[model samples]
Target: MEPIGHQTGRLAAFDSLRSNVAGTLYEAGDPGYAELATPWNVAVRTSPAAVLEAATADDVVQAVRFAAANGLAVAVQATGHGIASDLDGALLVHTRQLAGCTVDPGGWARTGAGVTWKTVLAACADHGLAGLCGSSPGVSVAGYTSGGGIGPVARTFGAASDRVRSFDVVTGDGRLRHVTAKSEPDLFWGLRGGKSSLGIITTTEFSLLPLPYIYAGALFFGTDSVADVTAAWSQWCPTLPPEATTSLGLMQLPPMPGVPEPLAGKFTVAVRYVYTGNADDGARWLAPMRAAGAPLIDAVQTMPYSMIGLVHSDPEDAMPASEASCLLTDFSADAAETLVGAVGPETGSPQLLVEVRQFGGALSAEPEIASALCHRDAAFGLYSVGVAAPPELPAVADHAAGVQSAMNAWQFGASLPNFSAGGGAAGFAASYTPDVLARLSGLAAHYDPDSLFRLGQVPAR
Candidate 1:
């Protein structure tokens, strides 16, 4: 391969890459450069030296090879829901064109990097199979699973990463390899939760649960009952079986399109539940919380597995938002009280939503194959989100940090990779234990000798 021009000659040199790739390539100021470079999080401004909308797995290989040979770093994006960096001066490979979804009724599915969980969920629903998808089915499967996917049913099943069977990836050295537990154990272990620290996944194959339906939905409570409902939820979580998963969210929804009339322009609390067991038993188990206060909307009922996204009702559209999260060792009564006092209704909290999801149960079990995912032992996970334009961005960020500080007593000092994006290296390091971090760092050095992925969420050496 011929070496491209460097630095001052970089703009013209990208022409060579365009010729080598079957996909469309966009340089800075190119006609489609802005569109291809934009991420789902509108707040992050990505200005890559070039953008290659990868049309095939080979396009990824070419991008990697070109970047490696040209002394440019490479970054990968699917739906851009988890963009952690601006990707300035890098070679951005957009995989949106690699849309492919194939489901085997025999209890597994294979999807392209660009495929979202919505596609897989629809395909799997046909055969009474369910993929372990995150709260938002709109997120890319490869991207979510790559970060150790935790979802509404995570407590009943394990994380989506725990279900992964293999990945077709392009490593930093520009090699396309099929990675599985037996074929490439190290890569398999790292890729499951390392989130693009080692390579760019072209496709992913994973097991699917034989779940036709689940008794699940959200129970919304009025502001007057927020405290009682949250306190009940905190006390109720400990009694739930592994077959049941639950979370509570304190929401301050703005009156807007899609926002329900009862929940719009007011503070509310939502008790989200998903039970894989008998519907009758599920309802019986949820009785205590149901009696905590009169529900403004009781949408809980037996529903087809494809409708799982209703449990959380995460926004389907892209918007500018700030997020903060931490794991909790416990959510005792005192912790619950503290949380209510901090971000509950009438607390002057600026957050759009603050949630605490119950952990443990199947989620705490050791996966048959060990992966880089850690902090499974945490009892709960706390996350907060706020939508703000640039002017309000700083206040939103500061408020998010304040919410975390309010719950510091119960924090586990760690977090899940899926919820911890844009944290830079220190934030990435906080997600793993020292040994795990050291292992990931060492593997990154070996696989990415030139530190091509060093710019974003990957751990530092």
Candidate 2:
């Protein structure tokens, strides 16, 4: 079978594609094709030969089969948050129409690929249940979990993929499989950390926590106090138990609405923390940081679990952005000094946000069902983001490189999938070990012999 040519807008197999699926199909020049094909990262221009707005798992199966038959590669997108590169004339499967979400009071959730953490958070709030959600609840549950989601409460609960019960996916071979630890175990393990490398996830089911509330929020200190506050935080993290999750970010927030006046248009350090324990104990654990320095805004307090979104308060609006990331073996005081000197106020960095998130506790331990998720013992996650624009974007990458160079001594040499979105083959390669990548590539060969899933973050190719 010859590989599909670079044909855009129309195809010889359009009739069969339309007949086999209930979802709408669009060519490049079609009225809705632009909107349907656009990704969350405006930086990536996806120009697929065809787009399928999948309405069902069966629709996904049909789309894969169609791509296989036509000798075309296939790509999957839910919220487009993980768009790595432009899809050049491939078949794009958009799972926006698979909006199914159901929660059991017994502390479990099942969601279609279209469902986001916001939807799951809202639904589960009614039952005092909480799903492991990343900073931005707007991200798709399936997409996030598939990439081994590292959420705000990750120190306590571990990665979202660790909590997964099962996944209903359409593999590259055109089969709709119901996968679990006991059934199709290899597929189950591969799908968890492989992202969309193995298949298009149609629906996902995962376990949830039953806490009604948490003692969580952010403590903001002015840049003038960055030195003092950072020192306190660096010293405090080592003493934290598994129930206490925390991170510190240096923010360069614009003076927009919802942005506090103190932090807007100014350099500030935000110490974000979440405690799963009781209020008194949580406060006792957090007391030193509260007294670290005179905070401009101290919002840390006991709040309902439903308000968990406020802890990180990540940007919800979709816009173009560039990011770089790496894990750390340890964050020593010397590393802290190196980081502050690298991207702090003195550096005049163009990047919008720089973060050093603590990792330990439950994150270091593997779950009962082991998976392909790697870098479990990483001590911290260091990431940076900048506005992606015509002239300034290049500087972001350069500046990020300089920062990583400054902290090279503590580098863990790997990163989580959620943070490696725009990273190329090297970035993707750093995400897993040679053994895991080899296993994933082997599985991709067996499950996707034609390399139909080449467009995802997977380095299967």
Candidate 3:
């Protein structure tokens, strides 16, 4: 892995790129090699031939052009929160330094690709507004939006991509372009769900809703109540109005400092909530779920939108993680029984968390604009996460696969881009319909005839 030496003819072109871009370019032996190549998902080791810490949009264009000219592929990452593949000879463009954000109180915000959800949330908070953010605010806004972000409020507000107004991107073509519903409609449609497969998103402009406060948080129940609570939630969610969105989690929390005393080192059930309506009505709506089981901690309460993270507190630190997810068409009583029998509290599931987010209402409604995002009709999404490469990893991944297999009867559509790994091109195809995938491939070919951005999950032409 010595810095792609002179023996390779591409070195000369790579060297020229190093001289032109304002960014720092590092090869295999560089001091930053270890740090730049490391991703948030530490399971897959990334071994890019060169790393470019792009300082400006121009630098991104230059890097793509160089990679294209030198017969090298390109891959882009900001926080590396959702890396799906290991980068081998691909030139990795680290977008962490492209930070910039602007909040237009009228209704929207524009952010650089590197900007995280917290940045937009804070800026929108100044205007008593909120962006459609994920469980954790640490995820990059563009990356999250591009992957059709689904969160606690997804059933109420729909995917983050649905709220997007525009995107500034560097396509695989080595050209920078602006994309939106009206201009470059095909690119706009593809970028909304196509993600980095088509290009590296430089910046994204999206709508922010007027949500000052919300009735949101999680209600924790003990292991004794897991069966009762999960069963009730499965039936109850289908009846929920559009204003309320919810998810249920089966968690086995370590007895760490942040762990609530009652839930420490125990298998517990948590019903996460997010209500975008009147507080009193929201409470009344949640009564059925609250009455499902005697909650260990009745933490759900009305709070400012800024505190929404309390509902589904994703980890703040980067760790080695492997996840599997799929959209479900139904969670019938029989399915629920099967799930509980397999991975419920008594079974001692190995993963850190098993979650099912109810999807319908606004999420099922098609966006006004035609975009590549598909599978809106799915009723729910199931996901599992655990440490990768740990001693128990093999068993954990196996158990997760078993859980997935058990739910096959309820699985309606493909896995989400943000949650799926393996299957590569097939995974991308599964995320959308055949027509949408074909359209995306056409756009990619038109924008990037050279196909420099084909390192990971790009649509096959």
Candidate 4:
């Protein structure tokens, strides 16, 4: 079937979809179309042919079937944290109404596409269990895991995708199927890191970690100590073991409501740490860095796993943001010095945060059943984020690129799928190896022959 264009005929065809699905459907200029289609980044705009606030898995199936029969593309959004396309002339299945989360005390969880990490964290905490969630717990569990979620405790537990047991998904052909390693090996491997390429996941079930508390938080140092802290962190990271996960950030926070008095409207350095071992040993291991400089805020301590978001304190509200990232071969002292010279306190950088996260340990280990998440050997990951208002957008993008260029010496020339959002097709291609990308493309052809989800983060055949 030929793809539908933006015309009155396409709008009239959606009338059949509205009656078939048990959900609300909105067309362009509808009361809630703009609000439902908007994403959390607020930087990229999306205008789908229609939006379906899916009430159940059947709703997703109906939407996909409608798109297939009517010659329209298909896209899915939950929290919209990682939207990369404008989704023009597509049928957007918004899964916010698919809120179902059930945690089994036996150490596994089943969450609907709409459920966020915050909900899962709280539910699992009741049983002294924890799910591997990204820095911000506000993101959708299915969406984050679909991109091979790397989180605060990644070094200890590995990516969230590594723990997934199965997925209830609707493929491009509009058939609902249960996907697992044994049931459909190829789809199982691709869906974990391929995002929405092969199907729209309606539910995800994954194993959870035991224990409810850990030694985790961030230590903040003022501008005067930024150099010393960065150097110490660089030296200290190489000596750490698998039980510890950490990242160092060069922050230039604006004076705002959530900003602390000491850190607001100032340049500072943050040493974010999460140690899953004994509290004493975690503190002892952190002593060398603590002694590096006089910290303005020493907030590191033993905290409940449910409160994990405090380690990074990523903003929960929607705002315009420009983000860029790349993997690093190694973060040597020279690399650390170069980073400080570029985006540190003295550089007059416009970026709100430039961070380098240590990667390895369990994160580098291949799962028993492999996934499409590549770049496991990267030594570290570098990311930069800046507020992107209309006037400042150009400056933010340029400065972020300059930072990436400045660190080219240690760059590994690849990025994590979760961090490569909004980078377009080239960025998406960089997340995988040539062979892995080829495999995904082949699977896309087998599962979605019509390329219904091609407008998403999927690679072209």
RMSD values, in order shown = 1.5, 1.7, 2.1, 1.3
- Candidate 2 residue-wise lDDT, 97-157, digit = tens: 9999999999899999999999999998889999999888998999999989887888999
- The reply for model 2, stretches above 4 Å from the true place, is 1-9
Pitting candidate 2 against candidate 4, the one with the higher TM-score is 4
Measured against the true structure, the TM-scores of the candidates, in listed sequence, are 0.97, 0.97, 0.96, 0.98
Alpha-carbon local distance difference test for all models: 0.89, 0.87, 0.84, 0.91
Question: Best candidate, lDDT-wise?
Answer: 4
lDDT of 4 by residue, 134-250 (tens): 999999999999899999999998999999999999998888999999999999999888877779999999999896999999999999999889999999999999999999999
Report the poorest 10 consecutive residues by lDDT, candidate 3.
Answer: 1-10
Residues forming the 10-long window of minimal summed lDDT in candidate 2: 1-10
Model 2: pairs clashing at backbone N, Cα or C within 3 Å: none
In candidate 3, stretches whose alpha carbon ends up further than 4 angstroms from where it belongs are: 1-12, 388-391
- Model 4, stretches more than 4 Å misplaced? 1-7
Per-residue lDDT tens digits of candidate 3, residues 92-173?
9999888999999799889998999988888887799999999989889988889888776888889999999999999878
Ranking under lDDT, best-scoring first? 4, 1, 2, 3
Query: Whose lDDT is higher: candidate 1's or candidate 4's?
Result: 4
Residue 126 CA error for candidate 4 (Å)?
Answer: 1.4
Say what the RMSD of model 3 is.
2.1
